[model samples]
Target: MEEQLRELGLEFTKEVREDFVNFRADPLAVVYPRSEEDVIKLVNFAREKKIPIVPWGAGTSLTGAVACKGCILVDMRYMSSILEINEVDWYARVQPGVNLGKLNEELSKRGFFFPPDPASFFLCTVGGAVANSSGGMRGVRYGTFREWVLALRVVLSSGEVIRVGEPLRKNRAGYDLVHLFVGSEGTLGIITEVWLRIIPTPRQRLVALVGYVSSLDSVAGIIIDMRRSGILPEIAEYVDDEVIRALNEHLNAGLRKSGGGILLLRVDEPDSERMREILRRWGVEAEVLNDEEWERMYSLRSQSALALKASAESMYVEDIVVPVSRLVEAVRRLRDLERKYNVRMPVIAHIGDGNLHPNILLERSEDADKIFDEVARLAVELGGSVSGEHGIGIQKAKVMGEQITSHSGKRVLEIMNGIKRLIDPESIMNPGKYVELAYEINRSEERRSSS
Candidate 1:
């Protein structure tokens, strides 16, 4: 297999060891295909050999999505390219390996932008974003990658190049395979290219940092009321007081100097008049800032990992998501975990979408593994998902069982395995991620005995 990969003029390097959420996995081979043809050749070769191939972007995934144990790791970063941008349709065709930040910069020149801005947008690749079906601050309004992706050119495990969806605005298609592959992690197939839906740049923008003297429930109530009144914000976020303080101490920047608990808000529209009225109706007492301040606030919200790393001895973020109505309870339960576990649980949330990144900062004395375990369990108990944005990488694989019911969980596993079998039946693509063939059997047997 390695010889065939090299023969195809693809770069095949020795094994590259990696870890996601502490789930360690090492690949037998790492292949970098410089072009789509290279990808096809490698896929066909792997299929013939019955070897699994895992498609990887920038490897910024917090979930076990990218971690592979003893399989072919196909790094898609080399495939980065902005193939074409259609000004007429306000869409762009890009190779999956293109960086989100880089792509946006190119789009900016043409007066368009992709709305899905994950925290790691600068580092994450578009293909990886699609694989995880990632979402971010703007997700409350724009939703996730699912909404932004218009068309896809994918190479199934069978070495068949299939085009799923199209650049059209609407379609009454049979089955939406585009969406299925979006969040399928790496279990489905390798994504070669993507046609992304782009939006016109907002003409007006406003940001507000609101301080609440009351509990999280009060802040949540404000959001509920705002939603009921039909005020859809472009971006709405929450940062616990503890998290704000940690950021201040970490960056030595006085961000914590302001609010009691903080709600960072950003609104955009072609008309600022409507925005101002909406803000007023929400009864939010916030200090409105211009574009400059708005950019600074966005920097603070998305660049949280830098602050977290600087402030804590060690840290891992818990990206838990629940329904909008369940967000308040989820936050309260997280606070309880903070006290019970004796760890620094600084909470920040995309409140509009009810997704929380409850970052756990740990010291040398604290058991990081135990703390993560408890947090994962809590995510399930609250009617929330184990991961909001980050896919189930190695970090959350163990707790994955808890997220789904036994019957439903087993069914998902079976479908994933079946799809894998149909694609790269040789089991060579992204070996251990999402659905691992070897582990599938073991887990199914375990489920039977437990029942």
Candidate 2:
């Protein structure tokens, strides 16, 4: 396999060592592919040998999605390339490994920008974003990764070059295959290239932070009211006191200590005067923030993840999304959960979309593990999922059965397994990460016997 991969211009080194996970000596070999052809050959070889081929990005994934049990890890960074830019259609065709920050920097010069800005935008690859269907703080208005991705050049498990979807706005074809591959999590195929939809940059913008003394429920209610009043900010985010404290301590920002929570919002328009008036109407007490200050605020959101990781010996990040109407109840419940679990829970969320990231900080103590388990269980009972942006990966695989209650869950698994079988019958591509080979085979057998 190594020789075949190398023959196709790929580079790899085999080492019996622990990758990413230092606590547990996880076994895996990391391989970097140089080109699309190299990825194709590697996939084919993995399929032939039934060896798992896990697609690796920036290793920013908190979930065990990229973690493998002695499988071949294919890193796509080396294949980073922006293949084409279609000015006529306003689309850019790029390799899956393209750095999102770099791509956006280039796009900004062209008077366009990609909207799906993940927290790890600087390091995460487009392939990683597409694979996980990632969304950022701006997702409240911009939507998720699935929204921007128009077309994909993916290599199936069987080493076939198949193009799915088109750059056009509408497509009512037989099936929407492109979306199916969006959040597949490397369980279906390897994405080599993507044709993303870009939009013209906004002329001017205003960002402000609001410190609310009332409960999150009150804030959520106010947000709904504002929305109903036709005040649509480009971004509306919420941060809990713990996260605010961390930011203040981490960055030494002399932020107010009185506010129980913080709401960061941004408005972008051609006329900054109108935007400022709109904000003032919302009682923001608007203070115009400079670019550095705005970035400091945004970085505080991104840095919260790193802070959580650093503060604790071990931690669990929860991506729980609920109905917009239930936003207050959701936030209130999280605070209660923190008290009940006796853990420090820092939250940063896209409140407009009702997506809250309630991160539980835990030390590497035996007592911490028990608390972590209980909190994980409580997260689902509160009408929220275990994961929102960070994928199930291996960390939350056990919790999969909890999310999909009815045949809907079983049906989803079946479909995923069917796609896997159709693409790679030998069960090689990222084996054990998603649906198992037996699961699909059993379903097929049941259908055959029934027929």
Candidate 3:
């Protein structure tokens, strides 16, 4: 493989790589493609040789989505570029390797900005964010990457270059193939270029509030009340006492340790009083923050995962989301799990959306996998998803299958697998994970039942 790639004049290196969560991959070679032509050539070579290919982004995937063995890793760093920013069209066309934060910085100078600010915005690539369909603090107001992506240029497994969707927002041509590839996790094809919808930054005066709550249930209650009262905050997040301690110890966050946790809320200046009144009704004291303080707090919340990672020997980040109505029940069940396992699972949450990330802090015990699956199952039982934004890489594949089968029915899994087969018939594009794995699990269960 090395000799062939060298003969083709492709830039590649042999290396053992690992993702943010330590999911390792030992590829035959990591290739750097500087253009779409290079990607097409590499795909053609891989297809001829029957070699599996995986697209490499910023490697900040918490779900092990980029992990592969004995494959060609397409490193997209050299292709990074902001090709076009059309203010009149309200869109930006960018290469797959463009740093999300850098792109936003450039967009800000033009008086426009992309809205999907994932927690890893500073570290992740636009391609990876689009691939994962990532959501962040602003998701409560702006939605996820899926909502912002307008079009995509993809290189299929057969070396066919195709562009899906258009740069326009209101295009009603054909099926939504753009969305199909948005969060496909590299299973369908490799994205070469992306068109993202951009909008002018809001000019409203916003107020940031921090509420020290008594418990996880209290956080849920506050969010529920705000929702019921028609108070929509731009950002509503929570971090428990253990997470606060971790932040203080590891990141020097200088946060007060409340009895239960802290709730961070941001609202328009006019609605700030209403938001404060809700906190007071819950018997929680609130602190108003200045612009600088709010930015620091937001950065700290984004780095919460890093802080916890430093404090733990091994951490399994569980991205489970329940409905707002079931938020309290989910919290109680999560507490029950912690008590049963006798482990301290510090939680940080996008509370407004019911996306709870319970960081299981423990050594690599035999029960860790069991606890992980149990947490996913709790979300399933509560009529929620196994993953709210994080893609189902190898780690959450089984539970994802369960969630889909139980909620959307087995036929949905079959259809997803069928789509995978249709796009990459040879199963060479990031094979053996996601939809394929889920389908295989379902089929195995069917075999057992028949026997």
Candidate 1 lDDT, 366-401, residue by residue in tens: 577677878777767777777778877556766665
Clashes (N, CA, C under 3 Å) per candidate: 16, 2, 0
lDDT of 1: 0.74
lDDT of 2 at 302: 63
Ranking by lDDT: 3, 1, 2
Error of 1 at 314 (Å): 3.0
lDDT of 3 at 32: 96
- Per-residue lDDT of 158 in model 2: 74
Mind sharing the TM-score for model 2?
A: 0.86
lDDT comparison, 1 vs 2, better candidate: 1
For candidate 3, write residues 1-451 as lDDT tens digits.
8888888889999899999889988899999999999999999999999999999998998887889898999999988999999999999999999999999999999999898888999999988888899999898888899999999999999999999999998999999999999999999999999999999978999999998898888888889999998988899999999889989999899999878988999999989998999999999979999999999999999999999899899998989989998999999999999999998799999999999999888876688889999999999999999998888988899999999989999889989999999999999999999999888987998899999
**Full candidate order by TM-score, most accurate first:** 3, 1, 2
Pairs of colliding residues, candidate 2? 64-394, 65-393
User: Which ten residues in a row are the worst by lDDT in model 2?
Assistant: 17-26
Give candidate 3's total backbone clashes. 0
